[model samples]
Target: MEQTSLNLVAIAVFVMTLSALLSPALNISPFIPAGTTLGILTLATLDSVSWGGRGLTIFLDLFATPQQRQRVIHHEAGHFLAAYCLGIPITSYTLSAWEAFKQGQPGLGGVQFDLTLLSDTKTIQKTPLIIERTLTVLMAGIAAEMMIYDNVEGGEEDKKNLRAIMRIMGISNSLYQQKESWALLQAKNLIIRNQTAYDALIEMMEKRASVEACQSLIQEKINQIEVMT
Candidate 1:
């Protein structure tokens, strides 16, 4: 869901109640409010447990403006492109809750990296560069959002992912903020450096292009950047 589940439900309840109150003067069916509420809950439940709440996202996103949609594409593209540039294998990605659900992802939208490397704790501990790469990847989405929006709305789970990695490293919380700033700057610079590839990625990502296709396109675009420079 773009908004929190609780907030969405609250908004639904408020609107239904308002509809009920206005039904008398508006000559709308008195049962309309109750029916709508029940229908929404039924759909929400079915979609949640069975469909990763995909239908709900579709419903809610019907109200989402074009800018909001673009923001999501841009945000995920940041992660996808950064991972590609860092020599990380990207497995898949999604641009919406429904697409994510279809792909069996737990969350609404994201770029997925190779789990084989991610699950290897031994390799990570042996290579501090791995940590640097992971930090930059995690910060890339937020950095991308900040690039276009000048602030961030997404990346809550991203921040949590970073904190978990820090805990695994036994790093002190005191340095968390500084580390985050550095990571963001690193990711932002990466995005800026690959501006053309990043732009191409946003279009492909929005269309939910295959990882292989985007991978090919990214290399081609980066080569073009190299040629021009």
Candidate 2:
């Protein structure tokens, strides 16, 4: 997927460059933006593509402003915070789809927990508690976006991930909707409950804290929350 996406991006860049070169002869200024739009549109239309998937995400990342970068940091921090509160050990996190692509990870960006811990205990089963915690983590990014922007758009990948997990558990559509809503509410409540710690973690993450630094920050915040409650 990564190679295929890299190839597609290379082709798109080539097309856009060719269009830019020809724009002078055609006396068209819109040609460059037009070609870029066309490239993005083509990538968007592919059935294999998800919102933050490799092909078009790199384009989005290229044009993302500083505010957008901060938003991604906050979004990822939400996942890390929620997981930490739930006792999930985060192994690493990324703030850019491009970074995730380089790491051979799916989705735009995310906090990766150490799921390998489960392997030592038992076969990881899709029990109710697991599903609930998973849903909360899945919706935490959306919750963060909604809190800051009054809207959310980056959770498409999260929703897709949730659906795939639910499918494995044989969850019904109605139950899925209920669980999603419940989990989102839980995530929002947790964020609200731990707002100070969450904000501190976001600041730490925005500064490009390393994995060990992030884990330390996470633990500190979680400990504070525990003391408070």
Candidate 3:
């Protein structure tokens, strides 16, 4: 499924790039703003390639050092750990561009979850637990990064995650700054408690596990948690 999506994205990019290259030669007015066109195409390509894998992998060879990759592993592990603890189902995870290209979604790497609970119309009246758990899960990635690296990079994605959580909690963006620190702290605690799961996740990432592998790993972890509790 992911491979097919990536092929489509690659074809789109090729067509757009070809059109851009040929426009001047054909004596035609540029049909689109070149900068905007390239920017959109770049984002689309990135999203398409990185959906189920680590977004950083695409640029890892060009920009990231070994330490940075380790940091990303921990960062993503934090997210996977927290979501698992919160009873969210993880569909897949990856740490390679080819995997992302195969899954073909967007942004950098991501841990896909079952959002069916959020979609339950009967649960329309939201609860505090839901809101808090959601925010903690969203902040878990950055918290994990900070825990290992003592700093953070690529936080824009985290902020977007936070914003979405806040929106779901019925809080406005204006209130995010006031609430973010506490949410991050909570996420850190969740990550700490689930350290074992985090470790397993990092190991899987180091192996460049594919979506199916990730799914199986997460399911096994979830079962372990279920048995323990």
Candidate 4:
């Protein structure tokens, strides 16, 4: 929900910037309104990218300080690790905030995973398991941050995370609550088990590694986890 709003804002900004930049060349008299509208559209597009889970979050984090970026990396790693443990296949991952920013999206970081719940065509009810796994994955990021920082930064981003959880809970009711707790436990365990990978991810983030580099590192780490399991 919040991501959608941010995308709208980003689209608006982009449209405005585009119009402003082109107004002089176009010799337009109504540049102000045109630029403003264009900017709004740009912001909207960015928000869409974020909601679509297109690495916009990673792009936005590029402006963050090293400490903040490290925190984000750890946070995202928690999510990835938990998902992996739950048998969720990751599609790709990125640590670059610039990539996200250029894409005009929200969130400082994110990991994309396959949303498919089963491999077979049988219609067995796996909704419960899927919901449980997803909630656990969502909370894993905060759990990771909490484990390391002892608490979160209490920023807009953190609030967004909390809201997302709450929204899920509202829809899923008690089931979501139960799954969230389970997810947190799973995340904590994964963090402990994959401390090395977590450390390496943070180090890579500190160096502002490109998306490709981050993806490669994460894949390698995933392979290591598979070997250990």
- Candidate achieving the largest lDDT: 1
Off by over 4 Å in 1: 1-4, 28-32, 38-55
Candidate with the larger lDDT of 1 and 4 = 1
Give each model a TM-score: 0.86, 0.72, 0.62, 0.53
* TM-score sort, best first: 1, 2, 3, 4
Please name the candidate that would achieve the greatest TM-score relative to the true structure: 1
For residues 56-149, could you state the per-residue lDDT of candidate 4 as single tens digits? Answer: 4444444568777667677777776666667676665655655455545434436766766532223214355665566667677878888999
**Candidate 3: which pairs clash?**
2-102, 2-103, 3-102, 47-105, 47-106, 47-107, 49-100, 53-109, 55-108, 55-109
Q: Candidate 3 at 17: error in angstroms?
A: 24
- Worst lDDT window (10 residues) for model 3? 52-61
Model 3 residue-pair collision total: 10
lDDT of 3 at 138: 76
Runs with alpha carbons beyond 4 Å of true place in candidate 2: 1-56, 116-126, 225-229
Off by over 4 Å in 4: 1-63, 102-106, 118-124, 154-175, 204-229
lDDT of 2 by residue, 1-229 (tens): 4444555556677777777788889887955667675765476557245544466666657777898888888888889888888876677787877878877776465788776534432343635576568778889999998998898867877888777767666678878788778888999998998888789889888776887787687678778778878
